[model samples]
Target: MAFGSVVERNVQRPLMRLISMGGAPILQQLHLEERLLRRTSDNWCIVNDGTAPPTIVMGVSGKVSELVEVEPVLRDNVPVVRRFSGGGTVIVDQGTVFVTFICNKTAVTGLQPFPRDIMSWTGQLYDYAFSHRKFGGNAQSITKDRWVHHTSFLWDYDVKNMNYLKNPKRAPEYRLARNHTDFLCRMNEYMPSRSVFTEGLIAALSEHFTIQQTGPETALSHDNDFEPSTKLLSPQDLQDIISSKESSTVQRVPGWPQS
Candidate 1:
């Protein structure tokens, strides 16, 4: 389905709460997605300029041993976080930009709440927003009534950070076995500045929603009482995964081997 049709099908454009969490910590940004998806019924679109510190974020079903170079990350004390969403593992720093959409199943009239459809819908949106730019990666977490679609755009990157992630056992055919440096491109090379890119994204988004501006905290219903399941893993946690040698039940992203 086309991106425009996702919204045009509805007689009234759905209200989307927009928040920009500039340079928030990866874990907190992740927790917010869970809160917005589970506690609230309204649609949301969150943008993060970058993560506070360098961190490796994995999907719910991601295997740290397979996707990350665990020893160096553990030795350097780099935070390793597993999000509630399902996607490939990514190591992000101040150079990465994040855009996430959390919506009710009813938000889009006929769009199916499946990963591929949501991704296709977003792909078209980006194509309209910045036709020349490329995305870092995207993943989706869908439930009976809601779904969150998030993507990373590499504004700039530190080569050293790429050392933290290993080549996936299965990768997209387009990768062609290129090393991290060759596989990823910096958005700054294409756009003048982060601000300019963001402005364009907002403009594209305006085509779909009324674009209500909101504080990230306003979306939370029980800030103090709620505990997040997605967290930055500790030394013992990594050790346990290493020791067990068991596989994960969570499904891998497309292009990744199922087993």
Candidate 2:
């Protein structure tokens, strides 16, 4: 179908708010996502956040003992935060670039508010936005009437930071038992610069919505009422997890040797 028909049939003059949040803590970013999903209504939003300092971010359902090596994390005093969204764990730093999309159910015609559907939609959008160095990965949070889709672009990274994460018992098959360095690639190695990639994303978005550039303050001005379920684990919290017998159970692979 033509772009005109898509606009006419689904959304007429759909407006999207674009906000750039530079170097925010992983917890703050998750809070922002929650606020947008709860307080806003019938609006589309995009947030670009550059992470500062290295921190471990995990899915809402993730368990510390299952996903992280607690000893190094405690020794180095690294922050470990679980987001409100359901996705795998990651160690993000200054080198990670984040883009988030918050949208109403009907913001995009023919787009369903399910995980796979949103992933496929974003996968196509980035294909248009970053032909050279596409987004590194994505995750989703969906509600009855709204959904949030976010992607992280790995511009560069410290290999040492990867050691904080344990090899997850359940991972995508494509990972093929490879270590972090082998599984992931740096965007700077393939694409020009971060600015160029950002420009490309904005240009691609123009094809979908009438975007208005806004500041983070504007997005946060509404009365705050949302409470996030996820929390950042303190050193004490990590120790408690280690001591708890209810920590996630380990599953052995059928052919793998057991300890």
Candidate 3:
């Protein structure tokens, strides 16, 4: 079916809650919690900017053995987290931004299933954001399920820079950090700032979904009544998570992955 027809069927299905988070680790935790909640409630959507503290997160399908130099990351006090969703491993820092959509299967229509339609709708959202920019790349939808749509953006990224950070021996199985290719900007030469792209994306998605724009909020904080999962990793537990991948190969640490 055409993308628009599929989206229309799903748009009015229900009120899907969207939550934008601060960093990668917190995003991972929230995604897990939302998935658990979906087992009972099943009607909320969440979007998060999983950037900050500059860490590398591997998707469920991503092999930690293939993604990073784990030992160095641990030594540097960086946390390597695994997300519940299936996608390639991603290096998230202050620069990377993330968006997640969560909802129930009944909320989808026209499309054969929830996953398919979510991917289609998400593609349209990215198209709207990129259309306004001179340089833009495509949005890659990883997996489709009744619960969530997982995707990432390749902003002005440098292939050499990523290689230096992850030190992938061969070209990455997924797209490597191509200097010019960007999901939200054109050619990566003269791109808009990360804030500009994020604002544009939020505006487009709000209009497309016919939902009001809600500002950012903390997912699990002491100030908020909502309690974080006790299952959350403590500092030592996080270290164990990193150390558990003892078999993963290691590479020399570059001066700074960002610069």
Q: Order the candidates by lDDT, highest first.
A: 1, 2, 3
Tens digits of per-residue lDDT for model 1 on 201-224?
A: 777776677789999767765455
Worst 10 residues of 2 by lDDT: 1-10
lDDT of 3: 0.47
Could you give candidate 2's per-residue lDDT for residues 124-236 as a string of tens digits? 55641233333376778898899998777788889899899998899877777877777877877767788777777776676678889887778777666667776888666
Model 3, span 109-185: residue lDDT tens: 44444444555666665542334332221122222445656555555343433432453344433334443233224
Q: How do all models score by TM-score?
A: 0.85, 0.85, 0.58
Candidates 1 and 3 compared: the better one by TM-score is: 1
The better candidate by lDDT, 2 or 3, is 2
Clashes of each: 0, 0, 5
Clashes of 1: 0
For model 3, the superposed segments whose C-alpha errors exceed 4 Å read 1-13, 21-50, 114-117, 127-145, 156-191, 212-259
